[model samples]
Target: MTQKTNIQSYITIQNNEIVLNGTSVFKIEPTDFADFSKQAYRNFDVQYPKFFKMDALSKLAFLGAELLLSPITSGEQENNIALVLANKSSSLDTDVKYQESISDQENYFPSPAVFVYTLPNICLGEISIRHQLKSENSFFIFDAFNTEFMSNYSNILLNSNKADVVLCGWVEFFNDDYKAFLCTISKEESTKYTNETINTLYNQ
Candidate 1:
């Protein structure tokens, strides 16, 4: 039987604000990580542990997953969740900083701290760790987001029954501009995954 999948929930972050499941969760103008951290914990029930601190990418992915999972996921279903993401700038900020450190001959010491974030897939790893999800994972990049590509890829994974649930989106961070959109997909029908529904969501 071909596994079916439907849109479960979605979150979008732009203009230094977060919108979850089509509702604005928090909006911060010119806010930093600390500001977001506080708001996320307060409004979303996120408890930041003292140890195993997370970085910016991890935090963003975590929040995105949390929002998507809250309304749709149950105990066992969470374990079956998978993550697939795509972005245009694949950790370019870290790549640039790493190259800058090596540019000068005298002070050319490459920092591992900056090196680890150079890969685009680290965000997926961070999210998996946060949620303890051990399922299929993939990361891809293109010059720009192709909705057709994303929809086809996601449909293939779900239709093949490779994953019981999938978390997918486009997360692009360039310079000071950051935009993220995530949606959860499962084998159910509702108002979220239809062609017209997705188009409306993107158009909004």
Candidate 2:
């Protein structure tokens, strides 16, 4: 018998609002991404001080992962879970800030802090560190959310035993706009993991 993968839980954040499993858990007035993220962090009472230091992309990813993975106790499922995240912008939002810091030859101030987040996968690192998920992880850049790739890749990871569960989705932050739709997949009798369902949750 083939093992079936199912979406254990899903969370979405966009337009200053956060929805988990089809319920609007948090919503705030229109504001900049920085303030919105901070408010969400406080509203959820997430106590990771390092969250404040992350770039926009990392902060967005961290918040989604934090909420989606909340039911599972930290350190309980150490290396069984994998993270596979995709985005269209690919950290360009942070790249712009980093460039400005060193753009001026005379006033060139290259910040190691900002420089570190130039890669999109850094968001994965932030989540992994927080959850202690030491397993296969990858970040892909696509013109849009590739549900086919996400479904296939996650299914392989789960079926092959590369990971007992796969947490994958899109975390996109560019300009002042941001959206995150993260989901956990495992062999459970719930929402069947499929391309259509992934698209539906993302659009929801």
Candidate 3:
């Protein structure tokens, strides 16, 4: 039942730049993750009030997803789309922030909004909420980008009946360094989904 999967659209955000496919979309001040994400959010003209309450990790993931997937109107089968994201830092960045918020014995104040994003998958939830996509999604932690893993898992999703599409890739953020390389996978067979292509796209 294995079938071809295509890269519908992909976006990479890093090094003070945002690129959708091979085209440069925007550039920023290259500041900290917080400030840069705020600027990028504005550049995309996203009107989500909840975006402000999201942690740095969520913001990075959200922006990348928005830059790529926002324009496409989903069909009734959108619920069959899957989300598969991986990262080296996982939620450590926000975990540290959350810890610092409660580590202080005197202040000892933990913001519920901040605490909510302690898991990396919360970003996926935010995307699901925005697009109303009810589908299978997973978050992975890796030392590096495992293109092979992503390709293989996506193949499984398509070969089986578990999913009709998958939004898969890496979303990593640590301090001022962050990157999100995300793409939509479907059986439409537009752009070939291969290791070489993903590596080239990620490096571009």
Candidate 4:
């Protein structure tokens, strides 16, 4: 059996961007979600040439994946990495717009482009392409942070040896407030993590 390892990282993108790696990185006020998406794409150096016209879901996925993969030091373990995410909206914002577009007969045509964002898991696809990761992926939605689910599922993946690393977090985009926090876990014991440690950090 693979040994258990846990490592943690935190990212806050609210009024400003703050990344905790023992200290704050920097902060900037994004004009909007699209602007934030563009900034992230550039930061990760995503090579996709046709990103602009992509649907909002795809755009967010692209940005999320870029953030997850940027700090990875073990791309060599691509086969053993999993992308697990939880969000509150579950693409409802996109679905709402899509439904509105079709609600009126005068503008009843629903574009396939907009329809695609209705599902929350598309972000996994964007991440897979960005990192060339072919490992397991999943997306879950709840009214609030489901710590129990996140911890249980991630532990299962690691203990089962199905993956050597797991990237798990919360990514929510609601109106003007957007927040994301991601952490990585492995089978090698590292000084960086523990259940107690995580709880303490989170409480702070």
Candidate 5:
């Protein structure tokens, strides 16, 4: 029998609201993506000060990863879980900002910190460092939320014995719009994540 994977828990953040398993757990007052993300981090009481320095894309990815991995977070899970995140805008959100920073010929001040997050995969690195995870990590950019790809690739990592758990979902931020939906997948028996389920959750 082929090993089965299950969706342990899922978190979705968008439209100034953060929902877990279809319930609105937290929501910020109406504001732009920047301030809304900042408020979300504050509400989570994230102690990491580096969060303040992160660009909008990284901040959103970091917070979503933290929330999805909160339950079983520990030193033991290190090197066991794979991070597979996807998005439509491949860090262009920060790319534009970085471009603007250097666009000012008179006040040109390129920030290394901001420039570091220019790649969408950097968020995976950030989460890996935060949790000490030394497992397989990859980021893919598509036209939109591709549920088939998310499910297919995650299962490959698990079935291939490369990782015990997989963190799969989308973290997208462009201009004033942003949304993050992350789900943890494991071999343990729980709610199974089918392609339909993924689409439903994302569209919710």
Candidate 6:
């Protein structure tokens, strides 16, 4: 038994450009991830001050989730939204920074701020906290985006009543290269939720 679902809304953040539901909403000159994220935060008028303190990975995912979920105004919808994020790097960028901090034996000092974002799923926590989402969430490290797993897992959650909507996609950031393709899935009448569609949105 397969539960049918559709992508209610989708967002892509890449190449210093942001597109929401196939419409270009924001674009900036090429810059480092930190500066780009800060510019985007100001451009979108996001009021989250903690966003500035997040690492590159968390900033990327948080911004994507912010744009994609901005329309959900109801508390029930927020609580029922589950997160399913996958990435290839698995927080390696931050891991490298953490390693550098403690690499020097004589000056071995670990920054708790850097250490807190060592796990890839920490970005999920950032998004969850920002949106007050207490729903089920999971992060997977795949060689690439596992569309089948994303699609199936989201469908299962929806059919099982675990979530009314699922926010799932890929958010990968490492070595100054990054991309985020996030979408909301439910039984809504929009783009069909399938492997091909997922791939298309990701590549778009």
Candidate 5 clashing pairs?
Answer: none
Put down candidate 4 lDDT per residue, 1-204, tens digits, no spaces: 545557655444444454554455545575777776677667656677767766565565555445555666355655567888888888777788788889999867879978867788877776676677888899999897686788778888888877777877777775646666666767667765555443344444
Q: How many angstroms is residue 138 displaced in model 6 relative to the true structure, after the best TM-score fit?
A: 0.5
Q: For model 3, how does the per-residue alpha-carbon lDDT over 1-204 read when each residue is reduced to its tens digit?
A: 567677878888888888887688998765777777888888778999899988887888888887666676464545677889999998998899889989889998799988888998999999888778888888998999998898788878877867777889999988768889998877885734454456567777
Model 2 C-alpha lDDT per residue in residues 65-174, reported as the tens digit of each score = 99987677466546578999999999999999999889899998799999999999999999989988889999999999999899899999998889888999999999
Which stretches in model 1 have alpha-carbon errors above 4 Å? 1-4, 32-45, 49-55, 70-78, 192-199
- Residue 175 in candidate 1, Cα distance off native in Å: 0.5
Provide TM-scores for the models: 0.84, 0.95, 0.91, 0.81, 0.92, 0.94
* Residue 59 of model 6, lDDT score: 97
lDDT of 6: 0.89
Checking candidate 4 for backbone clashes, the offending pairs are 3-187
Residue 125 in candidate 5 has what lDDT?
87
Q: Candidate order by lDDT, highest to lowest? A: 2, 6, 5, 3, 1, 4
| Over 4 Å off, model 4 | 1-3, 18-22, 50-61, 71-78, 194-204
Q: Tens-digit lDDT track for model 5 on 1-204?
A: 458777878889889999987788888779887788778888888778888877887888888888877666797645588999999999998899889889989998899988898899989988888778899999999999999889888988998888889999999889869889998887787744554466777787
Model 3 lDDT, residue 118, Cα: 90
lDDT scores of the candidates, listed in order:
0.73, 0.90, 0.82, 0.67, 0.85, 0.89
lDDT of 4: 0.67
Top candidate by TM-score = 2
Deviation of model 1 at 114, angstroms = 1.6
Q: Largest lDDT belongs to which candidate? A: 2
Worst 10 residues of 1 by lDDT: 50-59
Candidate 3: 10-residue stretch with minimal lDDT: 191-200
Q: Residue by residue across 29-123, what tens digits does model 1's lDDT show? A: 77765566457666776654621254455556667777776565554545777798888888886678678988999888888877877788988
Relative to the unseen true structure, what is the C-alpha lDDT of residue 119 in candidate 1, on a scale of 0 to 100? 84
